[model samples]
Target: MDLDQSVIGLTSNEYVFEVERRHVGQFAAAIGDDHPLYTDEEYANQSAYAGLIVPPTFPIAMNDGKTEMPLALDQRRMLHGEQEFLYYKPIRIGDRLRCQIKVSDLYDKEGKSGKMQFLKLDTEMKDETGELVCISRMNIVYRSLAN
Candidate 1:
């Protein structure tokens, strides 16, 4: 119903995932990306990456069930508004990644449809070497059921 400012800056539980070549290939295929870097191990092994590299948005799978808001928001009324990713380095197979979700911001506005609450979340992914691999920013819109 209303934006909960108290939940801003709240951090969720950390999740660790071990990237595998099969998963990377599957994700690339699911996204309709036919790049050799992602689908061809022999090609990737000869390229600059020297190994299988995951797609840019592949981190979504790694963060699955890893993050959550600190509030009790209605899941049925929530909409995925936007998503962005910033990568410091490429994610390769065999790397262990750690991801954590943080509630970055929360706000409410009156829209043509109705009053909408926006929740911004940031998920940081880092490798086992303590280097940042990527940062994903996701915005979710919570619409009042009455609207």
Candidate 2:
């Protein structure tokens, strides 16, 4: 197994994101979720929700502040190995949020198929009150034939 990179932790491009009403609405529409909890405020209020709520997967709908991924890895054999999301609080509209993102465990391996890069990314999103709203983890596997 060969290691492609030695990145230690979160890089300079890691960042947070805030969800807005417009972005939530667009995401809801794109995902075909029109439930009262995601759309109509009155209906949401009657359903025990404080206000308009985005779908459970709404956290990823917006581009947010996440950017500047490390380009050191080979892209020809890139693949998403796994993904998971954990929510600490219910995401509501008009809530300004801050996010922290970091990269962890950068390594590589050589298998019968080819060369593969193993990477783990952690993203944390918090509300203005400093309460964690959501955290998403992404595992990416990159396949490339090293020279």
Q: Pick the candidate with the highest lDDT.
A: 1
Report how far off residue 74 is in candidate 2 (Å). Answer: 3.7
Cα lDDT tens digits, model 1, 48-140, are 888778888888788556356556678888899999988888888888888888888989999988778889888888988888999888899
Model 2 lDDT per residue over 10-123, tens place: 454535466677887888788788888977878888776677778887765544544656445556656789887888877887776676566766776776876567887666
lDDT of each: 0.83, 0.70
Q: Which is the leading candidate under TM-score? A: 1
Prediction RMSDs, each to the true structure: 2.3, 3.2
In model 2, the Cα lDDT at residue 15 comes to 52
Query: What's the true lDDT of residue 25 in model 1?
Result: 80
